[model samples]
Target: MAAPALGAQEAAAAAHMLSLPAEAFGNDPNVEMVWAVKAYQHAQVYFNLISSVDPKFLKLTKADDQIYSDFRKRFSDLKIDVLDSEDMKSGPAKEKWRPFCLQFDGVVEDFNYGTLLRLDCSRGYTEENTVFATRIQFFAIEIARNREGYNSVVYDSAKEANLGTEVVSSG
Candidate 1:
């Protein structure tokens, strides 16, 4: 029947769309880390671009304010160091950075939940760091701060390595 044929064709298209790219192998240890770093970098660029227009658009709203509040509460509820919005504000440079942990629980039924991860935001003068959060949470907190004109203090550690590179003098 025509309906059966159409359904079969649709299934094939869906599978193709879900297929992974050619280079996604689980052999290397750094692959996941590299992917995460790239994702975070892209998110920063996108967040800056959008925040430049409507600053307050990402702030906690009545309908969904609890989401952000709940996320932060988890830190305190767990007796971990609680870094509120005030802590997120930029501050004077310091000799060392304080590290904090974030707890995340994804929405999907089969997805991992209750994962705690640590992040050091020493480069960024702000005390709060969302590096361990999901992309949505990262954007939410970062955008809210960006809206308030609190610039991100996160500095790239890679720059320090680059700084150590030496050039040979010509004879």
Candidate 2:
């Protein structure tokens, strides 16, 4: 059977992220950029595993792209667009930094045994002042029967040992 449409729970999660206090994420240099990269990588790995076992879990659409685009737009709004990989690495600036979008193409089965699209973001990195930091960001949305959807909880290197319940919600 065809996969179900995106559901309220998924929407709520997305909205919750949008409503988060930006200050919660500090720009401390010790934050270890690797955390972001690891989170995205783990999310992608989970997507791959789920898609291989069941092809009815996640589904991607034009709207999915729009969601990503909107998130990217926030960088511009924050006046940090210059920090964006796309704008920072060009022409003479190519030697300094570069940004990349994560890409994934896959399918998975949902709890109800329906097919869904798996949208993923891969690893991206930038080099500045001879220092390189990797930033990876991605999301997996599983669409089940009855038009319900939920996202996979992403874990980072920091949470690896503890296997804690904290979910990485952003790139």
Candidate 3:
């Protein structure tokens, strides 16, 4: 069967994600940047095929055998690794910080794949003194066929907000 068409919202979301600045997501180390690109490419392919079949099934059972095979090969080539997530804390004089480092060592099946990383930090002190909470998210996707490609980064982030709502974000 042929795939269904993308609605207006879906189209717009895809466009937005491609527009976000690489720095806005805090990928300064370079390797992580590459992972982002790879993930985006993988996602694009699945997005295009949404009309064809459910992506969840595609990822697990190889519902889209060709796409699955291609993904496996490409993913194997890109040897992605989390290099570091160092906690930076100083005594009275030093500022506190946490930095995450990652490395991408592999070839992307196509220029379409990319990734997104998000880091959030919150601070709180107990009555006696010291405790803080930090949360980090490293989201990556392999965009296969993004009509707008990287230009849709901003839209993609916005669309992601709709997750669990009316719109759903694809891997």
Most TM-score-accurate candidate: 1
Q: For model 2, how does the per-residue alpha-carbon lDDT over 1-171 read when each residue is reduced to its tens digit?
A: 112233678546544653556486576442223333333443445544543433234444334444345434533242221234443335633432222222322221111111212222111221231122222122212222101212222222223424443444331
Off by over 4 Å in 1: 1-24, 29-41, 59-64, 75-133, 136-140, 143-171
Model 1 lDDT at residue 102: 27
Whole-model Cα lDDT of every candidate shown, in order: 0.36, 0.32, 0.31
Model 3 residue 58 CA deviation (Å) reads 3.6
TM-scores of the candidates in the order shown? 0.33, 0.22, 0.21
Name the lDDT value of residue 40 in candidate 1. Answer: 48
lDDT of 3 by residue, 33-115 (tens): 34434344433443444434432333322223443344335443332222122221234211221111112222212222322
| Preferred candidate (TM-score higher): 1 or 2 | 1
Q: RMSD, each candidate, Å?
A: 15.2, 17.4, 16.6
After superposition of all CA atoms, the RMSD between model 1 and the true structure is: 15.2
Span of 10 residues, lowest total lDDT, candidate 1: 92-101
Scored by lDDT, model 2 comes in at 0.32
lDDT of 1 by residue, 1-171 (tens): 011222566556534533555366545454444444444444445444443444345443332354444544533332122334333333521111122222223432212211112233222222244434434344334433444344332222333333455332321
**Model 2: number of clashes?**
17
Give the TM-score (vs. native) of candidate 1. 0.33
- Which pairs of residues have clashing backbones in candidate 1? 124-153, 124-154
